[model samples]
Target chain A: MKADIIVDTKGLACPMPIVKARKAITAMKTGQVMEVLSTDKGSLNDFRAWVSQTKNELIAHEEQNGEYRFWVRKL
Target chain B: MDEKSQKTTIVLFSGDYDKAMAAFIIANGAAAYEHEVTMFFTFWGLNTLRKEAAVRTKKGFLERIFGAMMPRGAEKLGLSKLNMAGMGPQMIKHVIRKHKALPLPQLIELAREQGVKLVACTMTMDLLGLQQEELLDGLEYGGVAAYLGDASDGKVNLFI
Candidate 1:
């Protein structure tokens, strides 16, 4: 629900959204939370898969209209 | 994840602009995820790493021709399909710019910034008469064995 960083990846294509999120997460301290807003439909799965692979926790995600918001916590 | 699971190896074997773009996008993405990324440039793929300006290098008659015929760098590479005798790459570049996406050269720069290893295939360089000075600097030189060493331990190995 709360985030230390907010990354806007709206209208970006595949990889860019995830790329931005990765950069944001890297700069955060352990246990810090990030909110990512992405309009790229593919990022829904990409972010989930990437978070799992990197061992980060995807606290929750929701979709409104065509936009998606994800709350990720760095473990 | 373990180190191996966070490792990705790619063999770039195409000379097309679009293919090279895709490869670098994936490589950058993997590196963004904090994965160890290695891209081995082989065959025509070596063109992607060539220096745009012509360098002063003495070579045999055939070597000079090979050097002249191939695209000098990432900017000059043609597309694999819909080349349209060169118009295709231009259109692709236009849209890429419109989309605010990183161009091939910028992607390569990002990859370098992200510490993704860029290796030039020595055998291919020799065969194509491409001197070390003809390619972008700060690259590792190796053959297939070197690629295999990285790929064997890599969780994701790709031959593009």
Candidate 2:
């Protein structure tokens, strides 16, 4: 899963990770993929909710060693 | 996106820094979700829009005292609890910075960047004797009707 841009939100709290992700996604072109690395536990649900609300596609998401990675494609 | 169907309105009535942060965070978050968002600042919440420098204005004795007691601007706001003469806000700011989290001002800026409407309650401004020049620029001024108009069809309405 390759991405056009990778945003590392590690160690950031709720809203910050989502805020940073939104900013990153906004800069990318449509159909481009963004990889977000966040350590916030709540991001699992936050990203899902964000994608649902914004109509963006969450192509892939996984958690490992307490880190959450999400691959989102801009709509 | 159906902008008309997805609307969020926040009535920020608290002057506390922590509460203000929460309001901005929620507002920014909703805006990120492609929702039309509006924030109405009234009473003490108007302090968040105040400028650091004092702007001279004619006011009654009560309004003068109100102005003197409240923090001049967002930068001077204290935490709602455990403020310890303002140490709490500083500590929280330090933590937010350490965590790479956006502070309230930055959050507000991001909200604006995301097209969130910032509205100042004109009635409260008059009551508190806050002049237009005393507040930060790029804000819409209106009374409760304006707020009610924005909040009426909003799917999410919050008072913080």
For candidate 2, give the lDDT of residue A55.
81
* Best-performing candidate as measured by lDDT: 1
Q: RMSD, model 1, all Cα superposed?
A: 1.6
Model 2's DockQ score: 0.65
Model 1 interface CAPRI class: medium
Which stretches of model 2 miss by more than 4 angstroms?
B1-5
Model 2, residue A70: C-alpha shift (Å): 0.4
Candidate 2 colliding pairs: none
lDDT string for model 2 (B131-159, tens) is: 88889899999988999998988999999
Query: Who wins the DockQ comparison?
Result: 1
Per-model TM values vs. the true structure: 0.95, 0.92
Candidate number with greatest TM-score: 1
